[model samples]
Target: MKATHNPPTDVQVTPADLLRMAALYLRRHGWTQGTYYASDAPADNPTPPACVVGAIGIACAGHKVEHFADLDTDDRHTYLDAIAVLVDYLDDHYPIHLFDDDGLCIDDHTSPYSWNDDPLCTADKVIAALEGAAKEWDRLHTQGGEQ
Candidate 1:
């Protein structure tokens, strides 16, 4: 589960903060056992509650991770790595969460749709939109290219 793009280079939230928020989200979504107990599991038996896993997936695919360039490269790398691992974990456990009554999809607007009907183009769409916006900004600024 590679990231759709590089994580933001100016994010404000620390890795610790992301972890805490993720845990809180898990608990609020009824993944109490998974939220508090997952860290204790052995390597071969690591398992989060279905809802927790789904929430993680949604976070990975849709969460807003801010970008920050002030941090050292190592710190940014660690943050990116953490997100990658979470995405992989979620990918592996998707089936468990897809229909497990985890309440991850309580609102109709946010559900992950089937591939053919996916409303959230995610990676591709996001990049395209950003690029378009950047080009527009460049044009308006008239830095001597297209004015």
Candidate 2:
């Protein structure tokens, strides 16, 4: 009987790097583009709606710093799959903690805790969402087949 060869295991895709890959994916897919500004929002406005900026920030902060640019094709796919999971979670859960910038706290009308208070929460949530997503991606890839 012939034995199947296992794929090489020299490459490793880190969560931080995966996040960066996800950010790039968003950019490639027109999911994120352009500079974002909040000045036009009403001074009393509670929260800025979710936007590409948050997604981009999530990708930028969550990706692996050391191995971001260097991944084999298989590794890249694994990374992207993980990123996709994170993106999906961000789209669904949209956790407020993602964008919580304690330093940005202003007053009662716009406390970070409020759901409608800040975009920073989006960024913060990406990190948390990616953690879960990465594990799922890794499992899917290791087990076989696309996730």
Highest lDDT scorer:
2
Error of 2 at 123 (Å): 4.0
Q: What is the lDDT of residue 22 in candidate 1?
A: 47
lDDT of all predictions: 0.37, 0.43
Predicted candidate 1 versus true structure: per-residue lDDT over 1-94, tens digit per residue? 4778676698654333444444445444333222323344454433343233233333333332224243357555544543444333333322
Question: Looking at model 1, which ten-residue stretch has the lowest summed lDDT?
Answer: 108-117
| lDDT of each residue in 98-121, candidate 2, tens digit only | 333666534322211233234444
| Every candidate's CA RMSD | 16.2, 14.4
Off by over 4 Å in 1: 1-21, 25-65, 68-70, 95-147
